[model samples]
Target: MALLVPPRSRTGGIVALVAHPDDESLIAGGTLALAARAGVPTGILTLTRGELGPIGDPRLATPATLGEVRERELAEAATHLGAGWARCLHHPDGELPWVDVETAAAEVAAVLAPLAPAALLTFAPDGLYWHPDHIAAREIALRAAALAGPGGPCVYEACWEPETACALVAAAAARGLPASLWGLEPEAFGSPTDGLPLTRVDVSEVIDRKLRALRAHRTQIDRGHLFATLPDDLGTAHLGVEQWHVAGGPGPDVLGALLGEAVRV
Candidate 1:
């Protein structure tokens, strides 16, 4: 597919709601960076500071200080993505499923009210990796989008192409990496079989920015174990395009128009 730049004349903005600090970068950094480069205002709303995530280096942060460190890292990543703003709810990590759903939805709705983003990007209902926090965030974002009504932003969810996921899993196995490392299970990581219609965005233009943003979260990502360990060709091929499912949007075509030719419905 040919790459197309989003029109600079487009007004309004995009807001990404995620469960944790680096979730935005991991899932949609390239798209966000591209939007920012196109003059579309962009922001991120992270529900948690990711305090419970594995610490790559003990010197960087402790259990007590991880939240603070992650907050700063998230801010730095947003800067790299050229996001107009980023906010954290500082909710306890790993506890989102236990939080009051209505209350969380209200808070998310409040954030969306003022931004009135053209689109709201978030994780799919399966939460991509089946993380409880991710699922909770997804529900909250969907409810918040609904509360915003017709005039509010269209909602999109990042999703993996089944073929792409299978290929990555095969590659990881070839490298002797355990299936658990990639979160694979007897049912192929518990991915939904119904599947979602995909909209592909060629993010080659802003891949560097995306990588930089990913690297910004040093506390959570071990360079050698995660990013660096991926076979370069496979990594490039997979990361070059970001995919999304129109979750609560007016229509897939509407979102395609907003994102331009970069979006393939």
Candidate 2:
């Protein structure tokens, strides 16, 4: 029998699984903040310490201590995002794709099965920008959820609407900043605009919390980042909303219902 999760009113829990320490905040910080504020339990599962990530400022960490520093940062970020609990596994960062998927899935399943979260959010299979680690994270989350069969959490991929991704580049161009992201042109940065079920959560009220969570990952996101090029107001204008799609399991618009957002499927 499927485990009983709390209904759409959100009395249950939410867990976000991601490839790196900062990904939890980058992908669904606002939603996590909103859920926590509403007294819903929130959790984060980071697959790696992100040792291979950029050193936004060399002063924050050296090559030898980057992983340890990032682990601390992830804990702090989880606090800022209002996650009640979080854990980062000892997995290689950029080389996540080469990890043994079955072993990783079993490890993830061990954590998730106990919580039986109402929603499980992670990267899309395409990894949004096609990052291999992001793709691996999605696979891990899905397989973990599957291990629970009908009782598994509803899986969702928090992502940008194609238009939103395109607009970010346009906005950067308007400011005379680079108009590309991760070397991909604006036209290639987001999920396909195919007619998939979607939910747009208006997270304006908790945007500040999200910002703080992102800021907590100081070693990864510096002021020189594209998001930082825009002023706080402009950045918030874009970050205030988040997009998602249900990928598996029988579930309602778990996040939408929690935040009272209109489901735009």
Best by TM-score: 2
TM-score of 1: 0.84
Q: Residue 89 in model 2: shift from native, Å? A: 0.5
Prediction 2 TM-score vs. true: 0.86
Computed on alpha carbons, the lDDT of every model, listed in order, comes to: 0.75, 0.76
* Residues 198-226, model 2: lDDT tens digits: 77776778777887887788887666555
Question: What are the per-residue Cα lDDT tens digits for candidate 1 across 127-191?
Answer: 87788999999888888888888787778888765565666656666777532332244233325
TM-score of each: 0.84, 0.86
Backbone clashes (count) for model 1 = 0
lDDT score for residue 61 of model 1: 98
In Å, residue 88's CA in model 2 sits off its true spot by 0.5
After superposing all C-alphas onto the true structure, candidate 2 shows an RMSD in angstroms of: 5.4
